[model samples]
Target: MKKYIFLIILMGFTTMGLAQNSVSGTIKNRNNETISNVEISVSDAVIQTKSNEKGQFEIKNLPIGKWILIFKKDKFEIKSEQVSIGNQEQKILDIILENEEHHIDEILVSSVFNKTQNENVVKIDHINLKQIQNAGAINLSDALATNPGVSVVSTGVSIGKPVIRGLSGNRVLTYAQGIRLENQQFGEEHGLGLNANGQESVEIIKGPASLLYGSDAMGGVLYFNPEKYAANNKTELAVNQVVNSNTQGSNSSVTVKASEEKFKFLVQNNYTTHADYKTPNGETVVNTRFIEKDFKIGTSFATSRYVADFRYNYNDLNLGLPEEEIEDSRFRTPLFPSQKIENHLLSFNQKVFFKNSKLEATAGYVFNDRKELESIDEIALFMKLKTFNYNVRYYLPDFGKFETIIGFQGMNQENRNFGEERLIPNAKIADIGFFGTSQYKFNKNLLQFGVRYDFRNVTIQEFGEFGTEGSFQKLDKNFESINASFGFKTEITEKITTRINVATGFRAPNLSELSSNGVHEGSNRYEIGNPNLKNEQNFQVDLNVDYNAEHFDFFANGFYNNINNYIFISPNGNTIDDNFVYDYLQNNAVLFGGETGIHLHLHEIDWLHMTSSYEIVIGQLNNNSSLPLLPANQWKNNFRANFDVSKNIKNSFIFLQANYTFNQNNISQFETKTNDYLLLSSGIGTDIQMNKSKFNLYLTATNLLNKEYVAHLSRLKADGIYNMGRNIVLGVNFDL
Candidate 1:
């Protein structure tokens, strides 16, 4: 608590040291015609403004030093320029744009350098939240799964976990509001613990990213960008509502934002509730209901030499464990054997500008309280976790086509138990890492390389009576490793581009894997942990090729990852308390996969578009055995058309999609094979502008044929439970 107060005070002082600066600009097209409503944004800041009727725009409260400005508009090519803010009170500039037909690429801030996807050496996939909502996704994970090379592991419709390239659980990391999210992710049934409300977009890094995010990123990263504040000197309010047919669910949110030249503030409240979901055979799944309540508040302040942003979020969830088969009811309250989780997150980001360089620091604190109930008030299991993490980086001035950055990252976490049953011992974990990376540009080609060293310490406290069932002994462990990454991106020709990267990553054993000594609830398994497990390390190589033309585009991405000291669990042919016993083990593993897709626009019918993609992954151990919990291959196709109905109605569209999952015959020692299945869906949406208020309306129907199919990654697969059946969603949104 003292540390938090000290940091806040420091930021307050820094933000008041100097006066603010401003920038003004004018925008025009190649024909020398003014372009009104063009968006102008600062690359790394949350500040943005639109051009007025005269094609003039101004953004205030900028810090001193260098900044990148991006200009974007429909039917025009995007442009970027770098400018320096010195002693001038305000900088002025004029820009021109060219006509173009391709989609505008957004600036990617997740990378070291604030460059677009096409300009960065690393390959990243960026998806807008509006696009996901237009596709009628019920949750964030389901929306992300629509992208190639991504899948979901689900306990039910309400609980979905993200899986990237056959890696789930703790291997992948999630970031929100410019800080890492920590929410007891070692459990298989643990969900993402985040809502889609107030999110602008998501950027996915599909390979090892230890070079940037340190540990727990052996697989990849999912960075959620929050919705920006209203344009400078603007105040806005929005309301959204959605209803679902399958679960008898309703989702609603309200947001308000106010921005000034030097200060911005926002607040949002979201609520979601659902009853039991029904299958195609008119059978309702028992104890599958859930309710979530979320609240968020943020503020930003800037000066001539310093910028500070602070955000706070509170989330509460009442999730049901679908292990009971009792009578189906439409009650919003969850049944017994349920989970109640409450999470609180606070993030602070500060930037200090120098004459020739800059410094950035970010700090975050998270508190998670989790409880499981056997009855109305009887707590079966409970755990509370607290975490604090920080990152600091120094950006060196550009020198001879070179950009470099050096940083330090660290985290401190503590776990405690307060229930009758304990799954793991009370523990404390500490992590520290140091890294340096640089990017070199030459003739439209980019080369990037980096190295990092990390250390982790784990300390466990003895719990219960030692040498007995469900008892854990005290233990201490330390792990250290060095990792590195290299990448090169270049254009092979005017129409073709290629990117190749090689990176290494490492992960320290999680608490569940190192200290478990009891029967895990809901899984029906007795698990024994390995106290002397070695660190899991991996090296991966990624390749990407893209071809662009007037009427079509094609892209292919492939990767090969080899891991040493990979840890997994297998049955030990023993039973305890009428439950199968499993023992943790280690081995060398390999996973290889790729995604290929092509999109085409009809030349004669300008409004018609078609897209198809295929993704496959194969995971194997050193002994030539298949790995567990791997998703099957998939193929997806989409068709869409955009047209206008009237002058008041704009951007109207209709879409049809089909997805096929291949049969999974390769099974692990304790797994079963899954058959193939196909599903179809469709939707229609349009934007309407009334006299004063703007509105959006959409209707989406999933599982058009009411297919009865089970996915390979479903935890309920063992019980012969199928996925959700035909469902429809009606959504409406309006701005004031």
Candidate 2:
């Protein structure tokens, strides 16, 4: 009788939810123009749109819930509005963009989504809120799979990493709160140093940015930006919950922000836990669980022409793998080590404007540390890693609509490892470097470029047959290398912008590359290192073309990277101390790829809208073998429709979204094989307004049929493992 009662309640809720509703709106620029052909998106949000000609745009089929609307364009101002997709209120609105005056009159979106700034440095790619909310991600990797140039491999539900243009590991640099991330160097068992809960923006610098950000960035860099202020003087808060499609796991997030005339602050926290995720066949593949927490704080003061800003952020991560494989030769196969990592950042800046240019000085430090634990239920594992960074920059107002940016940065890093039974002495390595970047603009055409120089030194304490029992031998090794880069940006026309960038970059050997000793627990691989390694060099070229008009919006980019002295680990034919071991070696390789996105404004109807995007990558190692863990191809599509509620007492909306990822068969030499798969999901929601506060609610189902498949990087595949099962999520948001 109790079970029947619960079922009846569940059925009632399901029936009520299926009674879908919809919402709609129009976006326009200050010229009172429809701003057709412009892209509008929300970050760490749930809404997205494209304005049609006459600068008109709309979103339909939105969950009647509280959500933020973010407006963006290539050369226009950025705007955001808070509103509820209520049960009966029909909303008619337009967005206005001020000319390139440089003064932002609207929302403070993330760094990557900047619209008011003139095109200068590199063209950036983004993963906004609409993408996150509608992509049907049972997990973060599910959404990243939609990005063109990025490929994700997850070791079941707990392990995952982004493969950018065929590059992974240390070659892929990450940025959080404007600082280099330090977690990846720990081991393969670790995922990115960041989670998606509080992220307001994600920017991908697909090529060398070593100038503004010092060494270890030979491949590219990823930037994650969170909200700094609440829209207007209002307070913002929202909670999101999720249940995996294939896994019966649950996750939740709490986001809050407050700002006043003098100062502003915001905070975000997220949590999740799960048992073994299930496949469509109801099979329990692997038992996996993950726990993560992230937060950011910002403070800024404004007075006439003098405005100063400062921010601080902290990120924490812990992942457990149930059945990861232990192949001797593969990178993730043998699994380097299990990792529990913590990342931290502190930033400060001051700026003064003087008609010609704004003078600025910035300073900050970032620290990352990871300690390896034995994966075999508490056995001793060897490797430990950490990275620290510092930076400062000055920007001279545009020399006639142009700005020159000069900056210097410093970095310090250390890697430590000890042998258990081998009783081997510990090894140490130290690195330091400085770099600069500059930009010059002329009318519609802009010139951007930069250069960098880094010095690295490596040392080993005592080796076999060399020093006192516990102390004295030194084979201190030291080497130095110089790295640099340059680029060009041009506005071809009012509707088209193109950029070409060429630069030289490099990554110095870290403790793991030069020498690693100890048992790595998480990844369950015994670690060994080589002392004879050289600094690796890279040369890259990047080209981007963006077209913005009243009817269609498009973006496309191509990139090529050639590396000298590429470092990798492979089986060694010989043995060390009568024990089987592998050595870290360097080689040369080339990587290339491109991504494109398109927005189509259908015949403006009070009831409909649609958009789509795609990305791809290909890479070849020195042996001419395919690079490991590179994504093959990907695509995404979204549609929405609005219902007029003015005729009725209450208003409503309906949204429909679908995403697809083609086969990422691009296998590396070490990878045995990975299969291709696709996923689908949908949801409905609505909103209401009472007093000064707005209330929103919604229900979303992911992996509709509970399809089960292993992400390309799952380590439990041999054990017949699959990812999350079907999941349903309930969400609510409010703003005052």
Clashes of each: 0, 54
- Using lDDT, give the best candidate's number: 1
lDDT of 1 by residue, 119-205 (tens): 799999888887788788888899999989999998887888899999988899999888888988888776888888988899989
Instruction: Give the clashing pairs for model 1.
Output: none
Q: Write the per-residue lDDT of candidate 2 for residues 1-736, one digit (tens) a residue.
A: 3223422432232211212223345655565556664655433222344566656655443334434566766445566565554443456755566433221124433322133233435666666643365434545555565566776666766667766777777777877766666754435566776667666657676777666565667777777775546633447777666654444556677777765544556677767665555567776543354556677667665432334456776766555446445233322111323445677777655544333334444445555555444454553434344444544445554355444556555555554545343323445445555545555656676666555666656666655453222232455777666666666777788777788888888777765665455443343344566567777788899888877655567788889888888877665665544544456667888888788877664445524546677777777776787766666576767665544444221234466656566665667644656566666666766556666565555567766767766665565554566666666766555544
Q: What is the C-alpha RMSD of each candidate to the true structure, in Å?
A: 1.9, 13.3
The estimated TM-scores of all candidates read 0.97, 0.76
lDDT: worst 10-residue window of model 2: 10-19
How far is 687's C-alpha from truth in model 1 (Å)?
A: 0.9
